[model samples]
Target: MAGVLTGVVGALLTLLLHGAQHVVFGAGGHSFAQEVRLASPPRRLIGMTVAGAVIGLGWWQLRVRMRVIRVRDALGDPPVRLPLRSTTLDAIAQIIAVGAGASLGREGAPRQVAAAVAEVLCARLGLDDRHRRLLLGAAAGAGLAAVYNAPVAGVLFAAEVVLGTLDYIAVCAAALMSCIAVVVAWPVVGRDAVYHLGAHATAPNVWVWVVLAGPVCTVAGIGFNRLMEAARRGGPSRAIHLLPLRITAAMAAVGLVAMTLPGVTGNGKSVLEALVGRGGLPAGVLFALLVAKPLLTAACLRGGLTGGLITPSMATGGALGALVALGLGHDQGGLSMVVCAMVGAAAMLATTQHAPIMAGAFMLEVSQAPPTLWLPVALSVAGAWATPRLATGLKQL
Candidate 1:
């Protein structure tokens, strides 16, 4: 009874907090997009200056918790402190940075928030480790659900990535919390929808596309996937350490890239939306953005930017897929490619998180598009095929 009650309370708190998170996150995304696109010449320069400073400061402060904070190890590892305080502060700060035009996503930030909340509560209550772990998973599910309004995704995320497997009790609690979160986020983000719809088809028309989708996307993206592995496993490689100084030199080189192609520096939703029909810049500009966005994202992470790799993958996959679509089928091709990018987001994320069903489910819930759930399932599972091989660092299950 007590455990159930605690779980219920934790779930409710997560639901409520998620309401605030959604409104703030949506407003942040909306405002950040506008801030990026406005006519001001110095806007990006200012954003980067602020982002660089914030990242430097945030990382330094994070160092204090270094003794206690094992970011890479904490993937499925035990909690080191109370969950609520640390995760909530992290979430709030991350949302602020992302909303202000820093190229980070809200997904991982909320995981830390919800985990901290559950951990602290479980500790105070003297719950056993297993029960506390379950509670922690429930809280994570709720926060993720709130962000994307995807209940199944939330539950599966907790099970696959957080808990390493599903527990019947955990699933029930996650479901309840996820329901509360989706309901809470609806009014704040306005339940209209997040994804733009194109003409709905029953399935992919080409056997070739179907066969190619997995291989092409997997390959087109596998190098970046390797980059993520490199990023996670990187820092100082002794003899090879200063050699990466070449990357820093690459960063200073971007100062020139910025002179003409500034849009590549931050999150690329503005560019993604532009591909939808605005055509503010020519397709060539969009192509330049495709090249510049990924390189810069890698550069930023390599260059000391803070945050997850979700949005950067989304920017590249979406725009590149759109460009592919334009070449093959124009708008339809572009739209298909855009959908491909969305699938890539789920796929690449699945690779990183090692949670294909979870990632696929997340795609379904967060996207307003109808039941193309099969695509995500295929992409996610395929993307995760190498998880066992690639499961170094945070992905080691």
Candidate 2:
């Protein structure tokens, strides 16, 4: 029942996101990135500026009145209750912000709303703390599964990240909820993989690049995490009276950048699609995005905005991987850009979240990659997961 309700909520949120995007950017039948690119400079600037102002005001009011309990915090030992009104409002604000060109992932909104639904259901049924925690984690993962149609990744996310355990019982519950949510969401969200990677047989030399690029991606992922942390810590106070103005100013700066590089606007999905697609951006442009996307994301975080970093992190890794492939001259033959991008994405995701199995599963499920690519992907994930620890050990030595 919780999964069903969460699935419905996820579908509704997905519709609202698309509606908001269409209304804000006049996207019509086009993707957000294309619309932004086609829009005039002034439109891009004003759209983002207005979005910032609106979210700034909405979040300011919400924060001033009620304490917003994050999804993770709500799964505490005693099981913190997620206030329905405040949490839903926060989720809506996040969706609208992302829809209007905020450089943040849309995944967080669904997760919050789904978890809130689970919390409310658990309370009414008088579920115990243990059951409640398990349900909450499962619902959060279900939300992700609904949005992305990746049940395996959702189960792994619940087990590894939310519940912080792979206990058999918890894993079973998560898997059931995730599968249910995905099925319920199929009508609205479609069953297609989020990013399409055409057929490409895994080549022998691809393993070589994966091995060479793993440590590099690991370092980049760690650095990206650190940068986001710094941004959050250094951002403006949420309680400040002039928060709307500050956020507006920061968003306006983002708008200025978007005037030329519109791909930097949304949650990095477009960037990822371009990276793995044929005739991808030039090496110089990929490198520019490798630097620009994270900085833009960090800026949004610093502007007191809240959203997920998952897609942005993946996109960054993809760009880095493409660059590495180019550097090694793998683009000439024996390696496809798609494989490199996926490997880099998995490696980076594993490093950032510190969950190699989940990361690998996520990339595979979301891309619908062939089974043969698993070997290189797993190798990359293992290398990425170990690199940071090795670096720390070396530092200690």
Candidate 3:
């Protein structure tokens, strides 16, 4: 039952996002939210600010009626009954924000919606806390799988990260639900690789460069988290807890930044796709985006807009990798760049989410890289995971 509901909602969210993009940007096909852009800065600024304000207002109202519980909260904590009405509202708000180019990912909305469905069903079925929690994790992961078309990664994310431990039953349930969700979603959203990077060969020449990219991705991931924390801390005080003011200010800042560095806006999926298709970008441009995207993302999220950072992080990590490849003068046909992209994205995602296995699976699945590259990518993720632990320990001493 949870699997069916998750699949249905996931498919609907996919269609809704694509439809919104079509209407807003006059785009012909399924387009990433970031690709739906206005031609002029002034228009984009207005669109972003108003969209942020509306999202803020909607969330403020929803909070008054019922506190929205995050998927992470249900993963490790007591099973709190999720209210359907508030959950729906939160999903709608996220859709609107991303559809309007608010610099956020659309995946989070569907995950929350799926969790709500599971919660409602589990509560009525009189399931115990453990069962309810597991189902919620499974549904959330299934939703992610539906969106990204990554069933294995989704199962791992649920079983390994969300549940924190995996048993035979847990693994079976997660994998089953994720596969079902993807199957249901495939008709509405064609099974397309998120980023089609032709084909990747193991770049022996770039192996050292990929290794070097591991630490760079680690630093960037840590810095991204810190910026987000700082902005989160800085926001409420500045706005006196006023949601509209907070969102407006933060989104306005994003808009102004977008005026010059337009690449910094949106989830960065389309931008990443373009980079892959075109092989590589200028190192200077990649560097600027690498630095600015985290700051902009922090601003939007910290200012009270609800969205996921995973896609944005992936995009930024890919760009960072391309930049490194540029320095190595190995950016040909984007093969080397794509290799670096996989490594950096895996490292950053593993560090940020604390799910190295999921990170490796996701990067490989989405990039469609040759199996030979997976070991290097996994090793890079391990380094990324270890770096922070060592730093924190040294700091504690």
Candidate 4:
């Protein structure tokens, strides 16, 4: 029953986000908000600046009035409870941010909302702390599963990342909840795989190149994390939170970037999808986007906009992978290029999130890649994850 309810809510949330995007951005179902061109340059600028103000205001409210309870804070031994008001506000704020073309993902919002709902239910049922945490993790994973239509990856993510343990009961519950969520969401969101790699077959000869791409992805992923941490540092410092001035400056910066490079505006999903379909973009544009996206994403994160980094990370990784493939003289539509993309994307996601298993599983599920490519993907993910620590001796990632 809990699974069903969570699943239904997750589905509804996905639909609501899509509907919001359609109305706001006229994306018409592009998860990445591709249709920024649909709106005039002036309009995009106005919309994004307004969104920044709204996001800033919302964050200010939560920081001031509500005792914000993060899932990470609550995941520890002493389970912390979530406040419904704060969670709902956060979720709604995320919706508005993403709908207005903020460079972030909606995935985290659904998970947070679902986990908050689960926390409330568990409290009402008088569940023990351990059970509460487990249920919360499961519900959160269900939301992710529903969003991507990947139940197994959802279960693994909850077990591996959320709960930080592989308890059998928790795993089973997460699995069941993920299945329920995806099943419920299937009708509305449809059952198509997220990325369609056409006529792919693994090329063992080029597997070495895929392995080499691992280090590239690792550097990119680690670079992004470091930038984000730096940005996040300013969040609590009063000097950085200079009311409208700071927010206005940040939004204006984003507006300037949007006016010049609209591709960097949203989560970069459409951009990634375009690259996937077209194989490789012109080298200049590809490199330019690669450089521009992370900086913009860092700014957004630092500027008080709330959304997930998963999609953005994936987009960046995909672009990097395509660029690498192009450099290697491989056709974009070749199996080797696809493998590079998968490995690159998985590598970045795993290293950044510290969940190689979840990243690999998610890449596999979302791309629906042939099983033959799994070994290369796994190797690339493992190498990418380890390279950062080796290079910087940074165990924090």
Per-residue lDDT tens digits of candidate 2, residues 1-397? 9789878988898888888777667865456667777778888899889878988998888878878888988787474688888999989988888888888888898899999999989889999999899999999889888988899999999999889998899999999999999999889988988887754545566678789667988778879999999999866564468778777876787788888777788788888777665445678778888888899899888888888888889889888877776776665222477778788888988988888999999988887877877887899999987887888999999
Best by TM-score: 2
- After superposing candidate 3 on the true structure, give the runs of residues whose Cα lies further than 4 Å from its correct spot: 28-30, 199-202, 234-241, 388-397
Locate the minimum summed-lDDT window of 10 residues in model 1. Answer: 235-244
TM-score of each: 0.73, 0.95, 0.90, 0.89
The TM-score of predicted model 2 comes to: 0.95
| Number of backbone-clashing residue pairs for each candidate, in the order shown | 7, 0, 0, 0
In model 4, the runs with Cα more than 4 Å from the true position are: 27-33, 77-79, 201-205, 236-252, 331-335, 385-397
lDDT of 4: 0.74
lDDT by residue for model 3 over 110-141, one digit each (tens)?
88998888888987899888888888888888
**How much lDDT does each candidate structure score?**
0.53, 0.83, 0.75, 0.74
- What overall lDDT, based on C-alpha atoms, would model 2 receive against the true structure? 0.83
For each of the candidates, the C-alpha root-mean-square deviation to the true structure, in angstroms, is: 6.7, 2.0, 2.7, 3.2
Where does candidate 3 clash, by residue pair? none
Residues 1-397 of candidate 4 have per-residue lDDT tens digits of 5677767766776676666556555664345435676666776777677767766776776667777677777767455678777987878777666766777777888788888888889878999888888898998888888888888899988998888889899999999999988888888767887776655555655676677767877777878889888877664345534544555456657666777566776667666666655454666666777888888777776766657888788878877876777777777556566666677778888877888889999988877767776887889888877776677776545
Instruction: Extract clashing residue pairs from model 2.
Output: none
lDDT of 1 by residue, 1-397 (tens): 2223323433444344334323322333343344444524454454444444553455445434533232324445655554455555545545544444444455556556566656667777998767876777777666666665566787887677766766688788777766766665565544544454444332353323433444455555677667755653542222333423433343344434654665664455555445432333456876887677766656555544345555566666556555545554544434355454455455545554556677666655555656664654465456455444554544655
Better of 1 and 2 by lDDT: 2
